[model samples]
Target: MLYFLKHKLVLLATPKTGSTALEQALAPLADMVLQGDPRIKHCTFQRYKWRMEKFIQIFEDEPPQTAALIRHPEDWLGSWFRFRHGSWLNGTTRSTRGLSFDQFVDGYLAEPQPAFAAVGQQARFLTHPKTGETVTHLYRYDAMSEFVAFLGQRLATTITLGRLNVSPEKELRLDPALRSRLEQRYAEDYALYDMALDKHPG
Candidate 1:
């Protein structure tokens, strides 16, 4: 939302891909920052469908440059899970009642719900929403250093990389079985990430 409001760049803030870092870097440059709910990654189609006309009207009044970041599906999910549940450094708590990685994968595969699926989907939509116009830039999280440089050039300001928002030492303790299951669950996301990597080739 900072992208759209300030640089006129609509950034599709993908989850667990160093989005918080990007937001911080851009904070000084932004005209306004609109944060999404911590629970929901982005404004979903279903949620906005009811007010689509009004949303478009609001956009019509805004400037146009937009950008976003995306990451490999498995990596993104791993980071998300770790940040939300496994991060001992940040005092995060593992949920005792939530579905296991395998179960979550099953649900994700059965239904690609935006809220439940990977964050890359949000990045894709930001770049190419159902409304049709492509975003000005679509950045890959793996190439964040370069992307940051690009932003510096565009915004004409220097940016410094900071520590990740949620760093969990406990992530090291995650079972290999669970890790593999999560990776397998986000196989499609891996493919998409590969495609993005290929396109950028940094």
Candidate 2:
């Protein structure tokens, strides 16, 4: 996560959603940055509400405005599948090597997801557990230009981002039935992504 003390902006890092690029692009301008640890770097809005915001309120009347990016649910899971399918992890149980995209998603839908498909949901990461509140602003993962422009305007600096944490290329297709199941199981993520796209149609 990256926070700009002067701008009062907090950019929450949603996993696999260009967060690494944002961190690298904004770190030089940010007052504080949390990285290296998943729990810290990917801290959700709910955690920020009770912990970080509580502390920030000690010095300011209001907490910083929070923003995050959300990806299409299928694309998000595809990224995870290809990332773990890299040759370096071929022999590990965590690897998705040799597994079809459908199988990987099936693992995700399992009651107890296997290690390979245990990625957390974007909707869950962005929502407040108690109040059901999400971030103040949400950008679409596929719409990088809009997000970049917003950052430039808010931070008063031109921003550039390099691709980072890119997953391997793979054909990610699912049967119609499997996709229907995915949509049924992860409807909230789809809805949230649609909302973000509508908000920032870049």
Q: Each candidate's lDDT (Cα)?
A: 0.53, 0.88
Give lDDT for model 1.
0.53
Q: Summarize candidate 2's per-residue lDDT along 1-202 as a digit string, tens digits.
A: 8888889999999999999999998999988788998999999888888898887777778789998899989999999999999988888889998899989999999999999889999998999867889998898987878888888889999998998989988888887888999999999889888888434444
lDDT tens digits, residue span 92-127, model 1 = 223312545454444445544434334334434433
Using TM-score as the measure, the top candidate is: 2
The worst-scoring run of ten residues by lDDT in candidate 1 lies at 88-97
Q: Give the Å shift of residue 89 in candidate 2.
A: 2.2
What local lDDT does model 2 show for residue 186? 91
In model 2, the worst 10-residue window by lDDT is 193-202
How many residue pairs clash in all the candidates, one count each? 6, 0
- Where model 1 places Cα greater than 4 Å from the true spot, the runs are 4-7, 39-63, 87-134, 169-191, 197-202
